[model samples]
Target: MTLPGGDGPILTCEGIGLAFGRVQALLNMSFDVRRGEILSIIGPNGAGKTSVVNTITGFYRPQQGTIRFNGQDITGLPPHRVAKAGVARTFQNTELFAGLTVLDNLLAARHIFLRSNILSCAIYLGLAEREDIRARQVVEDIIDLLEMEAIRKQEVGTLPYGQRKRVELGRALALEPDLILLDEPTVGMNLEEKEDMVRFILDVSEEKGTTIVLVEHDMDIVMDISDRIVVFDFGVKIAEGPPAEIKKDERVIRAYLGEG
Candidate 1:
């Protein structure tokens, strides 16, 4: 993966700091997520990995820092506003609608683009019906891409963990985001599921040209799929490099082992 030079990164963070009461969650962290590249943020627990994602997604605002996406200063924007800026995210735990079908879950993401008024939308008439059909076609394409055809009509809660994860991923993909943030996408998966998830993630980046900011703990998955990595410890960035160099970093090893 050849990174673009001096063109400005797809996402840039500088001097990011966040706190709740006296406990500081993040401090002076900076990094760049290159366009069309998979950048993984790794760290031991309590190292503020999720804080970074929250800050980026506008779930939490940093006291200090400037966050730029596609060269726009988006610091302290709200989550929905951030999402409208072409940022999409999936939770660490599956946040699927327990009673909704898989297809309905994906359709929900597509609903934002409805161009018709409420009464027309309620009746599903004229443009509203056409938009519904269009949205379903896009959702169908996503179902095909994510291989959710067989279970598309099944209730999401009835699916197993790995499959629910796929639905969550598909939901994010449904939004057709420019930059996607995934938090521990393969955390609770078996080996086969993990491999499948990795393949899908890579496909999304390469095939769709979507930039990804991933937070994953599986070292082998991170090392294998990530183009670059930023290692965090105690809310501070300790190392930033390719997988090979990161593997040899003493600070990273120490942080992983809970050592000094």
Candidate 2:
């Protein structure tokens, strides 16, 4: 899938550094995410993979480094502003409104696109009504895309873990983001559920042409779905390449296991 913009890096991180007191979470991290490509970030625990996503999405501010998205400097932008700039993210932990229905949770993500004033919304007239209808239509399409029709009306807190993960994904997609960061999207899933999630992720990239930055621990899934893999160790990038090249990297082997 070709995006309107030329084949340039959709997101670029330059010299990113983050520290919590004395522990440095990320150190001089840099990477590029090409438009419409699936880039997977893999690392052992404490390798700072999630730290990178958090910094990019504005959940955490880096002490140093500049982040660019769509050629604009987004460094230190708040989460909502970054989202407004066409970035959406699903957390390593599900962040859905527990008491809300799947549909309502998805609708909440559409708030960023709402253009109606309080008066128009209260009256439910004109642009307000039209925008509400459009939002619902978008949510419905996402529900169908994620195969959540049966549980659309169910409260998220009552759903199974795997299904809740799907709902979180649906909520992110509801924003119609140009770039989506998925954090351990298939974690805690059975084989069947993992397969389903993988198919849905691929569908989003191939059909919607959305660029993806995926953080996953499942090596098999990462190698199978990623166009390129970035490996991190001790808060620094150890290797970056295609799946085949990453699979054979000695540094990656040593990071995951011990030197033999």
Candidate 3:
């Protein structure tokens, strides 16, 4: 498919490929994420779904092809650079600063905006104070948006698994990204928590206008929430379309559910 250009997709990966030593993890995989859309990447284990996320977010460099975000080429940029360029991600495993409070973790994500040098931070000068206050305000807003105000001061390590996951998401959002890459956002949650996460994700897309590219195993969640679906099998693109169309795809059924 032709990638959306000036009036098109928010993100696009064309002919992306990755290899580890002699093994190929992805082979000419390609897809597009339209602006203000939720696109889910679904596949079985080792189907290169997570690799695609890593490639897009610059955690891993693709051996071939390119990634474009906001109409600019960003292939192989470092992860920090990618984040600064408005791509934010939450890992499948929550990576919270365990010893820190929820608010502290969120505030830490604003380090990119710090104006005070290490010397000024050590001295706690006027500029340092102002930066600290500004970061805190941003953190507070994120906490309120994620409905974590009740636990803002609580240690992230002491929170429940689901809440820790939410805290991780809050930290990612603190970057104020234009695109959010979610890797299995609802992996271990109970039904209630999963529902809440789904609501939060939809709100983030609808209210925040953040384009979301999700790598998730929960078919129910993907089908219910995704505007489009991309299916992979053994590192190959087997199907790409809306969820309803993907659900009826013969290749998807054979690869994921086995042919009857």
TM-score on alpha carbons, each prediction: 0.95, 0.96, 0.94
Give me candidate 3's TM-score against the actual structure.
0.94
**Candidates 1 and 2 compared by TM-score, better number:** 2
Query: Mind giving the per-residue lDDT tens digits that candidate 3 earns over 181-259?
Result: 9999999999999998988898887778788888898889999999899999988999999999998899999888556
TM-score leader: 2
How many steric clashes between backbone atoms does each model show? Answer: 0, 0, 0
lDDT tens string, model 2, 1-260?
A: 77523589999999999999999999999999989889999999999999999999999999999999999999999999999999999999888999999999999999999989889889997889899899999999999888999999999999999999999999999999999999999999999999999999999998899999999999889999899999999999999999999888899998973455
What's the CA RMSD for each of the models? Answer: 2.0, 1.7, 2.7
Instruction: Tell me the tens digit of each residue's lDDT in model 1 across 62-140.
Output: 9998999988888999988888788999998888888999999998987666668889878876888898899999999
- Identify the runs in model 1 with alpha carbons over 4 angstroms from their true place: 1-7, 257-260
Indicate whether candidate 2 or candidate 3 has the larger lDDT: 2
Using TM-score as the measure, what is the rank order of every candidate, best first?
2, 1, 3
Each candidate: what lDDT? 0.89, 0.93, 0.89
